[model samples]
Target: MARKIPFFIQIILIPLLIAAILLVELKHPFPKFRLAALVLVFALIVDVAILARGKTRNLMVVLASLVFGLSLAEGAAGAITPRSVVKIDRGWSVRQPIMGWGPEKAGTYHAQMIDPSDNSIIYETNYTFDSDLLRHTVSADSGPAIVFFGDSFTFGDGVKNEETLPQDFADLTGGKQHVLNLALTGYSPQQFLHEMETSRFDKVIGPDPKLFVFLTAAWHAERTSCKAYWTAHAPLYALEDGRVVFKGDCNEGASLWWREWLGNSALYSYLIEPWRHKVKHNDVELYVSVLEAAVKMAKEKYGAPTIIPYLRMPKEYLQGTGFTNDSIMQRLSDSGAIVIDASLQKEEAAGAQISIRIDGHPTPYANRVRAAQIKAAIDEKLPGVLLADAK
Candidate 1:
């Protein structure tokens, strides 16, 4: 019989090989590393059976058991996470290669809103997307309007149609100001430019809007560089020669198998998306470029005054997120767009009045507060735009 390999070698060599394989898998772009890991695991098993003996064998067995237990614990945690429980099919989104995903269908869906703080306090509500794939409007269709463009905050994720920022703005003006909400959920500045280029506003709401309001949040910069999952399939653009150039749909060059696989994996999303954000190229330039394009479009197409209301986050959160209060304000000002200072929302958020307890979205009260600030800014800037058709 062959002499068994020493226990120390079995424990040290096997674990080192496994660790090396994992490190390579994590750092390398090749998919074959997974196969290598599997092969290494199998080889480790066979080697242990043949070579490990007594105390060494016992240690290897304990290590393997611990790894198995941790994996089970991880899977269980992922299974019961808040994200898993709130998987209602709202049917509000359609897959668009240009925008990655967009509001294509119109319907009201009874949805469950999960509070990120505590998932147990769930709220069931009706969410509606109009025929134009924008948030349902409350104000009447007549009179000059202010066009609102943004993502979920502007789309009113956890609030009713009447409680959205745009709707609240309309209400503050006492129905004299028509607010055309062109905002869509998960939208970025890139999509805003696309909407302008396609003349979606003209086709959906008639002549260009009197004023353009671009609501921006800190996450918009990170989202602009996201190319995995839904964003991987959406249309991508880049700034070329100081102009925005369409780079076509991401799915055209991406692997369908990889795309579909990663899109459905919660593990991949939970682990990889954040990692990508930290390691990927800085997206601030892309975001600023898109904003510049949008400002130019608003000026040239409709000669409308573009207002950028940057919904501020906590100061600590803004520090390393590629967006500073000063940098964003300066950029928009340089683009000839008026910038709304972050002071109002900053105070509201600090006082815990700007967001809901569970859902983390702007509450009705928060929207009302924000709308009031926006109206004040408009009144200060344009003087009589909000009071144009007052009774």
Candidate 2:
């Protein structure tokens, strides 16, 4: 009976073992760690069912015990994890098949980030969007437009209407520039590319857009790759024969089942999620390729110079990638983009501050500083527009 038990156990485990083996190989571009990971998984699966030695099944028993123990740990971690309370009124933003999450509807909605431990409100602010679903522009009907593209930093995550970067830029330029801020929270370069490809600009953007600017950050590299958990629905692009081409949504990868499942494990959250979302380096070439396409389209479609900001990759994201941040900037320059300099990007840590102590987003003052730099860049490129052109 005891001998038969091992056989039956092996039979039951075989299918899962096979599935896990297959999953380990799915869409994993990082070849350096593949071998070690395969070895570890194989040993675990083998110990659980392959081994049927003499008296004591100590090693096998230990491995089986860990499987259950880790599961329990995962459940516990998930239970205790602090979840912020977020409340948004109706028609805030709609779901877009291409952009994953589309523009915010024109209305005022309030948001806050509360500390779950003490149930304290960290910060509270209201957001107002235009009929075109953009955040804020001095006057969308006025002057030559300067379009902005970026994530929360450019979107002014926690700031109010008058304090956003685009708003600040308009105020600084005497409201002469019709700043079209297309920035949104959780946006990646793929959204930018998709919007341009679909000609969303022709219908929505104000007439005669003078220049486009993309605010730089280290995380843009990861987000653009569509490997992040929030990006499953994002329009995915791949490099086909050295050209970046759209290949539908990222969810089309049936092989990426493992990332979806394993990513939910709170044990994985502690052991891997932080580095998983951002800690490890992802495919830079694919990301930069998408960005390259955006840059070209900006010029070809709008006939305007797109100024991209350049920031060094934080040292933590330096591992597991062949190219450096400088290489990313080089890719932009090679694509006919002239300037991605210090005037637009601030590497100084002190320059960025937490907004109202709510989160890591830039404060209103920080946005003002960044806006001044962008205005300076625009003045140099466009020249005559800054003659105190207040609307």
Candidate 3:
């Protein structure tokens, strides 16, 4: 007769076995690492069970263990896109386009090549804006300054430098202003605040003429807490002695956080993005939170009244889309900043022209329209400032 095990031993071992399998299945702590740990625990549990039963199925246990381990190994690697298949250059943001899942030539821009088969961004740019950060510095003689801040839309992805909104805004103001596009791609409100704190625009553009125009999008109001952008990358600038310092290397804190949070989870790179992008707009509070913070910051720091220009999708794109512009308008009204509702233009001939492309970024035509809208809004909101500068 086989020896009976204590009830306590059975309870302990069985639960551990179950936990190991469940952890492996749930892909905890980067999946593959959990699987390896699970396999070892499971093998030990099976061995103890076999010995307790005095069974001759030891050969079967060994075979099962081998099969399980092999399956785990294959799953780990196969679940992710091969790094070799992707060729992202180490400095550009993912917003800059890649050609066929690879880096484009120096001048040409392409969007992230998401694999249609799996919806994974097989390749992404490193989002290093060292050069752009450098360009933010201006001479005292560089004339009046306006700092432009936002996300990919503000960064001018599909358009050239001259055709971008900031450039057009600069031109519209007739060389009276030097607009700095401090808007990094993929920057949410929290990151934008961090950029503001670190970049020390106060030091760069001192006193009153330093206006800040925050061209925020409707989507980013819900994205303020996306710390993931800073986790894997080095900071473009570090705040030192109330001035910006170019660190020229990744921060240790950021690197460690990414390694700990992300680890080798293939699902993180393979699945999370498409899942995240498709998430519907439901959190109105989060959007409000970001808007309030932006308004507070603008009121306190810059003292220059904030101007928010309404962004509109091409009319054709809005058809059949289950979206309501009312909430956005409401949010803008509540923010207490000047809102330029350029979307409600009755005559296409009345406002400046914009891009006809449904999905592509704002065209040069759109930039001019946006600039004109800003001009009108500024005149209405801050009576003396804009018009006085215009004269």
Candidate 4:
């Protein structure tokens, strides 16, 4: 007792179902399971269309079966996948006028970090930020404080509070020195200069810092110009007439609807980020200029000896690429900043197993190793800056 459905309706349904499956495949985070489900769904839909034999009742049953199957598949996927929880304590960060975003809240952020390579759960940890949005102390209240500024490496991305470079340095010095960490995750040379210009380093830290250190990696150069996930919401800068110039904010005049929908997708980011970096390849000059500006500010305002420590790329990745950190280091050295080449240290670290397997950030051992190298370099190069028995 069922009416026959038209052939045209079945034809339309087939293409629509395939298109729907394709869209899901593109957006789904779990590709393996999603692809399997897609294939199954496609096969089922085709079989249902053929078996329906133009019966309306069969078509309705097919629709119901498809809906039920998809719901079950989604539920299964959800049950197996671990959820990522990120809690940002009050006063952690606020939107800035030109910088787009900065740390404003002074509390701890707890989250389960996931490895992007395999989508595996890495670890759950807490990240604490001070009133100035700094992970370390605002200033050395007692004794001469050493200040460090840079991106996530300096921010101690994968490590705990005590495992950071500054903390290790403080511990190595027997806790006699104050180590100020002004580093922000995803910071470029531009943000470092901007923070120096705006932050209350003198009032908060009190007295002049004995040393100022700037840490960077080759990837940071691309961050200066690319609108990737890390730098997309940050302030833009350009080098004009041999001076650092603020261009504007990246999130300015953008619609939140599209950003919230597409920008949050990891797949979207994975695809678009590389394209953005490729298009904005001429950022080397901007990076160099920003470094010069930071060193100039440190020397002029704080009279602190500036040390720029850069992480070396892996030898395998460095091959066939014209990219080198030497030119940047040389430029910073020319501007009176002592450069610490971490290439040799990186090789040594490989032998020591000092980095995480899933997440490639430096481990606690690696941080300690870097700290030791930095202390040695300071003792050898700057002489009286560090204590004689600090190591």
C-alpha lDDT values of all predictions: 0.69, 0.69, 0.52, 0.67
lDDT of 2 by residue, 1-391 (tens): 3645456666667676566555665545442223433444555555554556643566666666665566466556656765436555556656666577765457787877776767787667887887887885665466667788888878877778888888888788776557778988888788888888987656666556777888775567667676576676778888888888888877755645666656545566566666656533346767777888989988888887788866565655756676767777887889876555542244345555534564767778778877777777666765754545452
Clash pairs of candidate 2? 174-390
Q: Summarize candidate 1's per-residue lDDT along 1-391 as a digit string, tens digits.
A: 9897787877787788778767755664453334344445555655675576788878767766655554454455456544543544656677754466765578886657655655564556666777777677777576667888888788887677788889998898877767788887777787788777777567665564678888886567666655434566554678788677877654454465566645544455566655665412246667777788889988898778888887655566456556676787798889999888633655664775667665677788878877887888887887756656642
Off by over 4 Å in 1: 1-82, 87-90, 115-119, 227-229, 255-257, 279-281, 314-323, 342-346, 349-352
- In order of appearance, the predictions have TM-scores of 0.74, 0.74, 0.55, 0.70
Note each model's CA RMSD in angstroms: 8.4, 8.2, 11.2, 8.1
TM-score of 2: 0.74
Alpha carbon RMSD to native, model 1: 8.4
- Misplaced by over 4 Å in model 4 are 1-99, 114-121, 137-140, 255-262, 265-267, 279-281, 314-323, 344-350, 387-391
Per candidate, the number of residue pairs that clash is 4, 1, 3, 4
Global local distance difference test of model 1: 0.69
TM-score, structure 3 vs. true: 0.55
